[model samples]
Target: MLVHKRVVRLNEKPRIRYGPMLIRDQERIANLNYIYNCNDIEALWMLRMKRAPFARLVQTFRSRGLLQDSIHTSVEEQVAMFLHVVGHNQRLRVVHNTFRRSMETISRYFKQVLYVVGELKGEMFKSPTGRTPTKIRTSPRWYPYFKINNIL
Candidate 1:
């Protein structure tokens, strides 16, 4: 009887070149500055908001303590990821590729940003008064079947 044997290596080490590397803070800052310097149209296409409005929104978030930079990522990148996910309805995998972040990190920050926005909902919205003008309210009823309050 003849038998064939297969050999396996037990002492092999995992590859380091295939592992992920941390993005430098300077690179992130430079990318963010370029985006911030873009024209209104370009900014709208990239972030789904005009440059001025986006800056104001970021400022508001910072002022309200709703967002901050993580040790590995900047506030601008986080905000951009959030907006990109929203504007394009992208999947987590796609977001990971665009932001160069792990799926878990992207998801965690996405949810955190959503939570912060929800927390600010009250401050962001104004209650509707549903009031009619005096002229319309005091006007003689042209049609008795129609009522302003009911219509509203």
Candidate 2:
């Protein structure tokens, strides 16, 4: 009797193609048109500088264990959601529509994100090393008094 063994080979390298699709081409054209035709400085400012607060909040949340890299939502999306809610002061439904998320999904994301932010606040701000300055209390006798008729 003769026995034969089967050997398996794996592809070590894979090839990838890099190019723009039809949809991407159209989007690029539209973006260029907007840049050329739109004179809205406020819109430009909004696109660039408006996300600072959200970025800070997202950083805080990431620092805490409540947020992890394994989550499906990108940090950018979370930050955008946060900014949309804060800048517009909008309701959850509005935020959901703005972020192009379902209301239930948006609610869940906001709930988790806010919970993480709160945890971060407690962990960071509760200590003196945080941004908040230490509170100081003055003695009653040393408190500054206004002089109405030169009376303490």
Candidate 3:
């Protein structure tokens, strides 16, 4: 029996489409608008934060020059990409689909926002005084049981 050989064709090249991609950017903006402007409930479901805090974060990123808009993606999109990945414990591929961004784009923005959040830690948190609060210290039920310094 003669063996059949598979023929390889080299004449046809793959076509790269640019028009839909440009349109996708426009759609991305619309999606972002819905996420931020719609309501706090949707924002909470997506970003794990309310609308006010999400807007404040984007504003802070802009005001401090911590992050800037790229030619195609805005700071808001970048932050949303980061938050969606982190807040929901999602992988890069999942966020890529949600934001219509490449994995590299999602990862890059994630890193940038993570660094900026680290920088904000000092302002966002205060050191504990290490002393029991007056309420707990003075309460008869919780005094010695919850005492920080005078535990018997």
Q: Over all chains combined, what TM-score does candidate 2 have?
A: 0.43
Instruction: Estimate candidate 1's alpha-carbon lDDT, on a 0 to 1 scale.
Output: 0.75
Leading candidate by lDDT:
3
Q: Which 10-residue span in candidate 2 carries the lowest summed lDDT?
A: 1-10
Q: Write the per-residue lDDT of candidate 3 for residues 1-152, one digit (tens) a residue.
A: 12322222334465776565668877777888899787888889999989898888899989999999999778888888888888999999988887888888888889999999999999867998877889988899998777657653
Alpha-carbon error at 110 in model 3, in Å?
Answer: 0.5
lDDT of 1 by residue, 1-152 (tens): 12222223334565567544435445545666777798998888878989887877778888878898778766667778888899888898997876667899999888987887788889867887776656666667733333647486
The estimated TM-scores of all candidates read: 0.64, 0.43, 0.70
Among residues 3 or more apart in sequence or in different chains, the pairs in candidate 3 whose N, CA or C atoms overlap within 3 Å are: none
User: Which wins on TM-score, candidate 2 or candidate 3?
Assistant: 3
lDDT of 2 by residue, 107-152 (tens): 7777776766665675546544422222311334433332222341
Residue 25 of model 3, lDDT score: 77
TM-score ranking from best candidate downward: 3, 1, 2
Please report the TM-score between candidate 1 and the true structure.
Answer: 0.64
lDDT of 3: 0.84
